[model samples]
Target: MSDGPQRFAGHQSSHVDSDAAIRLTDTDAVTARYSAVQKGYIRDPFTRPLLPRGAQFQPSRPPLINVGTYVRSEGIDSLVTQWLELSQQEGKKCQIVSLGAGSDSRFWRIATGPHRNTVSAYIELDFSENTTKKAMAINKSRELKGTLGDPSNVKIVGGGTTLYSPVYHLIPADLRIPPHESLSQAFQLIDSAEGPILSPNLPTLILFECVLAYMSPAASDGVIKWFVDYFATSPEGTVLGGIVYEMFGLNDSFGKVMLNNLKARNVDLPGVEPYPTVASLPNRFLQLGFERAYAMTLRDIRRSCIGEVELERRANVNF
Candidate 1:
């Protein structure tokens, strides 16, 4: 919990278990976790693409702007692409799981006609309270359908709904704990009547975007290991999909600048680790029995866009 730079002075008062403590569950809490200066940098129109629109609170600059957004966006795109590809190959129901999916509108963004049919289910995992808030927001937005007109096709069902329709399942589980146990229990309870149940061969696409950076390196390693181990429970040829991670430079100029600013404010984040290089990530995957897979950097994506903004991409592997 005490991994990175303390962005706000008042944040220290809330213990990790405190209700006021900032966690990934609430969008505001997640946004406030970033340094004020970083928040500013993300708001800049030119750099806005790096950060998701939902996370941006106001227009301001932070010491670490470009690196943050670039990594986040690239990770999101990577996972989405992997999910779509896996669905095509398996020719079975596709299950898309978003870990710490904070205000990401990917389900709506990519949910087109044929594409929607490919995905049998879309699950967004976050804190129970946060997920409830998101569902409420979606429902309220519907009342103004005349104006917004159901922004996303996400249907808010009281319980689990049909697989063909877009359903948002808010599984309130904590990432810091063992996710598999909780997930197994959830599947048992939710997938009782849903024939075949949740299996590895069901084309599961798990995504962790902008979530790993907040955790310590050991924690991140553990999380990845858990996923690999969980997938082993599935039948052979059961692909675990891709694990997309977006990380910022640890020793980059921007990082140093942010550290100095935090130091001046009398707040220290001792456990913060810099982004891991691409070459190193493949080995991590190999340790978990995952093959060294495809990867791309934010720099390459920006280059393809032919924009003036220069972004840095680290070697990322898809496993």
Candidate 2:
């Protein structure tokens, strides 16, 4: 069965409030604001390059026993760490592609820092609306820095213009469908000037954080298949960096308790049949033609920030 874009539209608004939910038409603007809010809360100074002034502000969490922080910090940090390590690998320049990259600053932050020269390309793929917003943000940053005599190293790639420095190529393609075909068109536009995909000597790392769970199982499977197909065919070997923070089925008393809580909140997630243990993620990766390079649970971070939580899994995939 074929699913159009709206297959997931209803699910999107249910995940967050209207103010925080990413609109298909203005996803880029929403992403920028979301990133600004995150940076302000995490106190990450690097976010200054992407977020506009006065964009930083704190949101009040639900009083008493809010477990959302664990959902954000550990899951997000693990994904960032994986991407950073891939970027800093020795001898070869790596290409980092962020899938559904909502307001992520790793490219800008890492590119401008010690690993700037080590990265061959930093591509951020998202909805066209969001990608355009990011480009505008990057251009605005360049303008602001020019006034201060300190220019940024990021460059927007699509729309037929290419600059010399580390190009922040924005391939605005929808991932919910066949990304390879759409992405191929975008890359052709980019490859016309930027040369070719970065060499295979340095691995390409793709990051997917907090995105799959929101997708239907079929769409999620399509996404995984797209990545596996890309890496299998691409000249470069690709490593997938993924953070899965949503609830899966419970196998034990602990798992049941977690599910009950989510059920109480009227959230029903698909994908886990009879709900496999979170540790079963490695098996899922292997099923999708990816070998698990590393896996860790952010239970500690969850405990510290959001009280006791049953499961959060982070893994790195190599093909």
Candidate 3:
């Protein structure tokens, strides 16, 4: 789903904790997805399970938001599907690590979708509090816990903050912290008697959806570089792909207004300020040693990548 201004501001700014506002962004994301699902803009049965019980019933987001969510979800789904298919073509399964993953049901979707077998491992990392809540929700849901294979294999460790299955893992992590201290240690849990959860030989895809904008450029780059270095020594010539969905170009009038609004709520976008234009978005990866990278706004994707039927459907929904 798209992380628009409306979604970021979905929760009331009444919490005294600073990171509470940050964590609520996940609430905004899941609720927006629920809204889109209710409006016939998307199909996601798993999203409902991940949402808090209190937020299960809510009015639909505006038509524009529904459309944006549709486009954003479709676009990322397309890329992830392609990654999985590419791994299949190479006779290999891929690993996906979603940083700052909130109440996202992507792993469940991929595991049940056609590309289910193409994923060797699916890992999600988020703040400890969010992970604990998600872990509890998954623990309580039959549909969600069942997808992780045998209930016996599922272990809730880290004092119920981490859940691990054969193919899926939900771990608590704060991305703003140093990756070496945070990521490297957390990954150790994935190394089992079978092998490491993240094989250096396999193609890996790092997803940074609506996350990078919440951190400093240095911290965000460190996260990407950590992954880059992890696969750099692979003799198999492993390919590491990255996808970042964020807001940029806040110097413009509309952008300034959006920035000011977030600022008013104590949410600072230090990561976005570095990339003021779509043209500069690729630099986020390329400069960090990615062989290639591309940036496409929701507008361009809607105009070119989306089919006429979908556009017409969105138009009808809007009208």
**TM-score of the candidate numbered 3?**
0.92
* RMSD from true fold, candidate 1: 8.8
lDDT of 3: 0.85
> Candidate 1: misplaced stretches above 4 Å?
1-75, 143-166, 186-191, 195-198, 259-276, 304-319
Given candidate 3, what's the lDDT at residue 162?
A: 92
Q: Tell me the whole-model lDDT of each prediction, alpha carbons only.
A: 0.51, 0.51, 0.85
Q: What is the lDDT of residue 301 in candidate 3?
A: 79
lDDT of 1 by residue, 20-47 (tens): 2334333442343332325332221222
The global Cα lDDT (0 to 1) of model 2 is: 0.51
The TM-scores, one per candidate, come to 0.64, 0.62, 0.92
Which segments of candidate 3 are over 4 A away from where they belong?
Answer: 1-16, 317-319
- Tens digits of per-residue lDDT, candidate 2, 155-253, equal 445552222234456666656565566555555554436455433344667666545544566767777766677667655555544445445555579
lDDT of 2 at 93: 62
**Which candidate, 1 or 3, has the higher TM-score?**
3
Residue 205, candidate 3: C-alpha displacement in angstroms: 0.6
